[model samples]
Target: LLNSNLTSELLYENFLKTLLYSIISTVPSCVFLFINGTMLFTLRSKPVFRETCRFILLFNLLLGDTLQLAQSQIHFLLSVCRVKMVYSLCIILSMLANLTNLISPLTLVLMPLEQYVAVCYPLRHASIITVRNTAAAVIAVWAVSSLNNLTRVLLFFKFPFEKMELYDLCSNIALILGVMTAEYDRAYTCVLFVSAGLAVIFSYVGVIVAAKSASTDKALARKARHTLLLHLVQLGLSLSSTIYYPLMMSLSKVLTRMVFLWIQNAFYVTFIIFPRCMTSLIYGLRDQTIRPVLLYHLSCRLKVIIRG
Candidate 1:
């Protein structure tokens, strides 16, 4: 069954790229998990960070990203080793990926709405959006994302993979997600994407208008505007890969194995890791409460290092 005509050098190059990429991604994955844990601890005791809705959203977003990163590395290892994923494991990974990915954008969409409520409805903000309410919202996001992806999982089970299901790359997994659920997933994804996109856009637009209305506090207005812009930038990055799943399906059909591997690597760096890293970095730098706490901890660590 093996391709006897193919050269061993080609196989070696592919393995080398996969190994290097796995290492590169693993470093940041570990860093983000640490940052997220620190942020979670900072939220627990700091009244200021605890009360802020945006920081809570960021915390959950980072948590989701951490899980996604972990799953990605697992898949990468499986690919590099050329291990065939069991049917049950593939389904589990597919569900986990769906859960994490959906939670992020949905959390992001809610963030702008949270800001809009705080900015536009200051008098009612406390009554409507308390700490309890924000926590409930995050729970609800997880619930809804699970429900949405559950449909796909059931569909996936209904029509299982026909072959041995061996894969040497992440793209292969993605292709499975796309081709297997092509009929239902496209419509579902498009609708879900469009609705969330519209909500984010509208919320940000309202936030901008409300910020501009506060002409007396120019500095506050400027900061609000900048924060809204950053959220928009992050949202754009998140959705830039909105159509990529389906695109991967098409690419796999046409491209050669090596060509697809390079393109897949490019997409992973650009779409997968970029947004996850930048969004957390933006939150860590932009949030007043988080930044000081992070810096203080960093300085303390540095001092201990010097003393040692």
Candidate 2:
């Protein structure tokens, strides 16, 4: 029995280590990819890019991603290292994650809407999506997201779990799943997912219809379509994380905790990393202006390496 207990402990520690390594590596990579690409683009592109509605949207999305990843990392540390986070700190991290949960998909929805306006109403797009208005939209998104998650956090605090010994032990998805076992938690989760999903779907549909009917320049139409498609893909990826919550809950009942944790790590590696990397690659690095600047940097590095 003692040997068996030791073996179980070993397995748990190994699983925690694996989760830590996976999150630390992949999440940071995604965050840095966005940061580096955006900074590079800003440096390389003219003042015009900074003022564009699309760039502002992208910036807000990246900001949301960074906050989400940072909170995830803290949760991972608390989980894997078995570090005890203060009750308030843990709650704050959970709230931040909840905020990010909304911001990402909402930002994605905005992207296609912006594209649709640019494509179907080119003459009026500027006036419709001015920088001041775009900034207000972003602020509104943040405000709405916070209030929604704040409701969840308030509901969470009323639970008796806070008095339990294991309350401090829970973090990351585990904490999320634990709190979500309540009926109200599930209701809120479904509401968040369904509402965001519908918004993205409606936005994409509008963009597609506009793209098809627009008598605009073919190249412009194609670019608009491509941009909308990218947003669609990103939104799908964002929603996958939401889908994962229910999945992890189901699988945990059948699997050992260690095995379930490993499975969660696998999901993160596959789903989360892909969207984060692809967003930077498909949108930021692939921008016509940004691409040339990237190539120039690559060539310069190659020349230096050859000389060395």
Candidate 3:
């Protein structure tokens, strides 16, 4: 009886470790998703911006982030409860999370590219980034992301493990891949690190060049500068997370785990928390149109409470 109890205790401990990581990762993501959703809805209602492309890009970003958050939540619950369901749901959610991550970065990359064209090639920008073109680009982004994620998910579900029976098969896949192809994982990490770094760097450089060249509208230049700064900070956080992910995944020693946990916490705070907080701050304080609308909605709610 004591032996059986000990075995159960050991298994539970192992399960808890994975569950904790999933929960910690999911909570902040959910918070950010909520904030992004609120901002997207607010932006959609307003006609302050004439550039539909920018709106669409932002909307897609929000959607991707929300999907990621939802995926994380489901994964966390599964990890904690050790629920074994049909393989189909597991595959679908795993694919969805991977798709969201892929699309988020792709959309992020496109945003700066669009901004660059708008600022640098103003004469032909309107014609180049029309509604039809934007729609096509978005469709292409989704198609590529879905296919890429599907490949990874398939690889994950096919791996075999004997010692640790994974209640959630999707996680089993990730563990197998992580262990079997560490180099492949590292290479993927490097790509994300480099891509995010390049996007942020080039975007800011373009913004700086535009601000420098624009001698006439001082107000517009100032606003552009502020926007550039905000984007730079956000991208910097993203780059940091991308860099940290590989290191955390590869490290093995006890000391390394401690260090990795601290780094991961920092990454979460910066990338997940800071972006949403900054978005709220920027729109609330800087954007004249959004600020008034937000206030009006709040005031109406408050009036209803007072009257009741």
Candidate 4:
């Protein structure tokens, strides 16, 4: 009787802890969703944002970030609730999540590259980073990410899915069953990050070198350097997301199940959800053009809630 009572007490305590963690995870997600949605609206509320090269790029970044954040939170909730999904539906959700996850870091490279051109090649900035070209670059980013996912989706066919129609979870690792597919994912992630890091590095060095030039606008060059630095931080956060699952799976081997659950919840908030929301905060605080408008939208939202 005593053992049974203690066991029941412990189980009840764990249930409460999980409930608390889920609430904690959801609160910020809701806040950021509101912020991201407003920023998206603000970006389109004015002609300058629509016409400006940087603003269009910002819109693309936020759009991906916002969509991915929603998808990620939903996935997290599903996992927490122990909701099973059909394999076909899981593939679609996981693919869309992966698609949006790649967009921010990929699009991030272009934004600061725009800064580099404006600072290093002032004469050609207008021609090089026009809205049309920026749009093209956005399209190209989506195309590349989509193609990569498409390849993975095709590779998934190699696995015998005719047997199991329901999946315990929906994720890249959950869907990608073939040894070749997993290797391809790791190889692709490594190549993607290395190439992007190189491009951003070259852009960083170019801006720094331009900063030394007497003819370069010191203030603009300085801003470009700062912009490059921030993008690097954002890139680092995005890279951390890729490692979250593998790291958790590795740690689960040694840790106790309860401890693993605790750590996993914390890491999910830190890596998955946090990184997705960082873009909005970074741009909202960093850009002069976006600051007032973002704040206005935020305040108006609060006011509406207060009145309601």
- Candidate with best lDDT: 4
CA lDDT of every candidate: 0.69, 0.67, 0.60, 0.84
lDDT of 3 by residue, 183-299 (tens): 555566567556755775686677667767754244654565566566666555544534433443454233454455445555555554554345455545576766787566556
Number of colliding residue pairs in each model? 0, 0, 0, 0
CA error at residue 89 for candidate 2, angstroms: 3.2
Better of 1 and 2 by TM-score: 1
Per-residue alpha-carbon lDDT of candidate 1 for residues 98-191, written as tens digits (9 for 90 to 100): 7777777777777777767776777787888888989999999899888978887777666646853644444334445545577666666676
Please identify which of the two predictions, 1 or 4, would achieve the higher TM-score against the true structure: 4
**TM-score for candidate 1:** 0.82
How accurate locally is residue 172 in candidate 4, as Cα lDDT from 0 to 100?
49
C-alpha lDDT of residue 242 in model 1: 58
Per-residue lDDT for 188 in model 2? 65
Clashing pairs in 3: none
Q: Candidates sorted by TM-score, descending order? A: 4, 1, 2, 3
Residue-wise lDDT of candidate 4 within 1-308, one digit each (tens)?
A: 99999999998987887687679788989989999999999999889989999899999998988998898888877765556888888878888888887888788868878888899899999988888899999999999999988997888787786766766556543565668977998898888887778778999999989889899999998888888888888888889989987887677679985787678789988998888888889888789999998899889989999999
Best by TM-score: 4
Q: What's the C-alpha lDDT at position 179 in model 3?
A: 56
